[model samples]
Target: MFKHLKSDLPSSIVVFFVALPLCLGIALASGAPLFSGLIAGIVGGIVVGALSGSSLGVSGPAAGLSAIVLVAISSLGGYENLLVAVVLGGVIQLLFGVLKAGIIGYYFPSSVIKGMLTGIGIIIILKQIPHFFGYDADPVGDLAFAQVDGRNTFTEIARVFDGISLGATLIAIIGMAILVLWEAVLGNKGKVFKLVQGPLVAVVLGILYFVFTQDSETWGISKEHLVKVPVPDDFNSFIGQFTFPNFKVIGEPQIWITAFTIALVASLETLLCVEATDKLDPKKRTTPTNRELFAQGAGNIISGMIGGLPVTQVIVRSSANIQSGGQTKMSAIIHGFLLLISVILIPNVLNLIPLSVLAAVLLLVGYKLAKPATFKRMWDLGWKQFLPFIITIVGIVFTDLLIGISLGLAVGIVVILIKNYQNSHFLHIRKEEKTGQEVVKMTLAEEVSFINKGAILKELNKLGDDSFLEIDVRKTRYLDHDIIEILDDFGYKANDKNIDVKIISERGIIENPKDYEMFFNQEKKENLKVTR
Candidate 1:
């Protein structure tokens, strides 16, 4: 992990900027103490990042869980009791990892995964538009369309013009300009430009602008427009920020219910983000899903023990890490340490950075995610892939992350079923050269399942009397029992219809096979039902 310190260190700084505001905003949205989010971010970065097999995935307090956290807090009677649930949830996640439930992540279709990334990208842009123009009504990390501020996504954007802060808007414009300059030209110019990243410059400029223009009537950026990390006056006050869980309510049935809920939701979100992150990885690294779950579980346990929200692998920060050229998990770990040190040593200095500058940074991240080229590429893949991709984006933009992914998965499954029904086998008919008889040859696909039963049956039933039939399974693997039954029944009917049957396979050729089930059973026992 330390081998790429030059790259990882700079990327980690970018992730720190991305994670900082999100940590505080998610905590505020969840109605948890502000410091709890920071703790989760710190633990997520340092602890989970160290343990996880993911090279680039960054975990933290998720906006997806804010609603869940808020309700759990209210229902559990207090934040302390909620922390109990969080700890239990971590245990459950660890159990999930041990059970190898990580395989579930691989089952999600590529179309849906791409859609998720695009949907998140679009959400980031939409959500940050208000902030970019100096309107901070919505919490920084909230991704849902309907907001805690009593306005929907579009309504909030509509209100942005009215609440626009000139200083913030101007600062945001300059920040965006710097980012564009760096991305388009400066970043590739020299090692110096690479070492000193554009985001770091933008943030420093935002701080300097805030410091210099505080007293200027027209140019002043107000407190409401700045990053709001809680500043502790002294050592004891800083330590007091950490809260402990109430163990007394551990036996409560409702507490267990909440714990299970958090574990299930956090685990699902992590798996999905893992899938998306792998897709975005330049090196195409595959994260060990089970290990990732175990790492997240351990992180959550540590976080909850010290007054933090439940943690998950977050896509926004992970994507930012990738876009910023992060090479390893060290970036995530160092970012967490940065969060810890910043809040402890320079909380006041961090508080001086304007929210709009962060918005500019996120705007770039969002664009890379939902690029127009991606849309056209998905469309070119045909309706089977495009439908799910578009639906997922719509669902995410209108609802939330998981809901959008669920909708896309539903559509993707239907597309698969349709494709399977149509592509079960191929049929060819020709006249025998010498005998002048019609010969029908049917070749089964590489894999035949119960879903293909109807299509295969229809083709077999259409075979005419006195015709020669040839069934080919040379390329087939893992034929389902239901499909074997259909072929068996068809063989009997074909014999009665005066159709001469010949079956070909990798094992051997059989003429007019009387017992298809027995033959397949022998093949299954030989472990011949596998793809090479």
Candidate 2:
């Protein structure tokens, strides 16, 4: 993992900066103590990275599961009880790995996966807007459609007008400008520029800004806008901050249910992120899904025991890892240790960073996820692909993450069935070379199912007035009952259109066609049916 030490160091720094705010924000959203987020981050980085086969993927406390964690904690008695569930959840995930359930991640359609990433990106941007404007009523990293504070992304923005802090806004603007300049200009200058990441620079500048404006009461920058790292008076008191899980809760049924929920959701989210990170890898590395699940399970178990929120492979942090030039597991490991050391040794220094500055960093991350080109590319793929993609995007935008994905999956499945139905048979209009006449030929394959009804109807509609149509079933060994009924109905309709119908089969053409049902029954009796 440390094979590329020099190259991995800079990337680790970038991921560290990106993860710091997210860890805190997600913890706040989950209603868990803030330090739990850091614990998860530390465990995810060191434990998960050590066990995982993935090089660039970064695991941490996810905003996606915050809502679930919050509800589970309330229903299951308390945060410590929830920790018992989390530990059990980790065990379940390990079982999932043993059962090889990780393969389920491979079945998601590419369009839907892309849509999910884009949707998450949009949500991140929308959620960060309030923080960018110095609005701290909502948590910095909440992603759910409705926040615990009884406001949503849009409503929060609307409220900003009534409660604007001039100093916070100005500091936010300056922080954003510095971040933009570092990324857009300075970042490309040379080796030195590349060594110093934009996020780290922005954070440093934010602290300096706060220092200069600390005594300026006229600037409107309140204490609320600044970072709020909990400070313990002494070393012994600081050690008391860590919470331990109540082992007695292990016997409860609700704890088991919560455990299963966390395990299932966290594993699924991690698998999806693993797939995404693999796609973004410059070296095009393929991650082993089972190994990733095992790693996540291990990380979660350790995190839960120590009073941390559930950990999972998070795409937001993994993307930052890749974008920042992370090349090995060493980078992820380093970042994890960084989280541990910083919270322990430099809690006071961390407290100086303004929330608005961190918000600016996330705003950029969000913009990159939902770039304009993403929509354009999806549109160019045509309706079959585009419909589900757009539906997923819209659903995610209006609803929440899980619901939007479910809607898209449903639409995508329907489209697949429709296409399979259409392609099940062959419809063609042929011209005889010898006789200069056009003849319509409809050929049913070796087997036909109910899904073929639409194709049959479409071909029937294409017949011209007073034209001869040939329905060939010579190659068909079995035909579905529903399809036979449709043909009978089409026969009746053919007479009205002045179209002459001819049926060709191994049994020959039927004059009255009264025995059509008999032919179907005979095929079924012969045990002739087509498998998918």
Candidate 3:
């Protein structure tokens, strides 16, 4: 992990910026204390990152769970009782891990995963545009299509023109220039620029702008536009932020139900994100899903024992880490330390970094995700692949993450059913050179499911009485029980219809086969099944 310190250190700073605002905003949206989100961020980065098998995934309090958290807190009576639910939820997640339920992460279609990445990229770009100009109607790091303020992703953009801040716009422009120069020109020229990243430089530039223009009326950035980490007045108040869970509600049925709800939702969200993050990793690293669940469960348990939100792998911060060139889990752990040190020692110092610079950093990350070439590539993959991809993108942009993915998966299943209906046979039919008889020949596909039963039946029904028919399954890997039954029943009827039947399969040639029914009906289905 330490081998890529030059790469990881810079990337950690970028993730630190991305995670900071999100931690605060999600806590605000969840109606929890602001510090709870920070605690989750620290625990997610340090605890989850240390135990996870993923090289690039970053975990934290998810915006997807904010609504659930809000309802749980209100119905559970208080924040302390809600903490009890969170701890129990972690135990449930650990059970899920031990049961090896992580295989669900492998079930998502590749088209949907790519669509999710591209859709998130588009959202990041759209969402950051307003922040780039210092329009603060919606809080920083809110990625939903519909915001808590009743404004949507686009309406917020439209309102940007009416209230652009000159200082912020100018700072953003300068920050972008600094980033490009450092990465494209200066960074490549010498070892000096290689050690210090563009984002860190851009942040420093933002701080200088704030300090130099403090009194200027037109050019000065307001306090609202800068990074707003809450500063504690004294050491005792800082110690007071941590809250313990109320164990009095441990035996309540309602508490257990809420615990199950959090575990289920957090597990699903984490699994989906794990799929997406693995795809985005430049090295194409695969994460162990069960290990990830165990790590997240442990993180949540620790976070709940001290005040914090439930934890899950988050896509936005993970994406930023990838774009910024993070190479290992050290980046995530270091970023957590940065969060801890910044809030405790330099909250006032962090307050000077302008929001515009962070927006500039995110803008580049978003563009890489949703480039025009990606849209064109998806279009070229044809309607079967493209429709689900587009639908996922649209649904994600218009609705939310889980809804969009579910829509894409549904469309993907429909496409598979249609393809199965059409692809039952690989055929080559022509008159035999010597024998003047017409021949009907069919080669089965590599895999056949029950969905292809109708198509296969239709083809077999079209065979003529005088024709010689041949069915081949030598190359097929799997033959469904239904298809085997169809062939067996057809062989019996073909004898009376005067059509000659021959089957060529790995089980050896069989003429007028009629014993398949006896196998399935009188004995076990697996007795005759052959797999290589």
TM-score of each: 0.93, 0.86, 0.93
lDDT (10s digit) by residue, model 3, range 433-492? 887677988998887878999999998888877678888877777777788778778877
Instruction: Give the residue spans of candidate 3 off by over 4 A.
Output: 431-437, 506-508, 512-532
User: Which pairs of residues have clashing backbones in candidate 2?
Assistant: none
Error of 3 at 243 (Å): 2.3
lDDT of 1: 0.93
lDDT of each candidate versus the true structure: 0.93, 0.82, 0.87
Q: For each predicted model, how many residue pairs clash, with residues at least 3 apart or on different chains?
A: 0, 0, 0
Give the number of the best model, judged by lDDT. 1
| lDDT computed for candidate 3 | 0.87
Q: Which scores higher on TM-score, 1 or 2?
A: 1
Instruction: Please give the ranking of all candidate structures by TM-score, highest first, separated by commas.
Output: 1, 3, 2
Indicate the residue-level lDDT of 101 in model 1: 92
Worst 10 residues of 1 by lDDT: 523-532
Inter-residue clash pairs, candidate 3: none
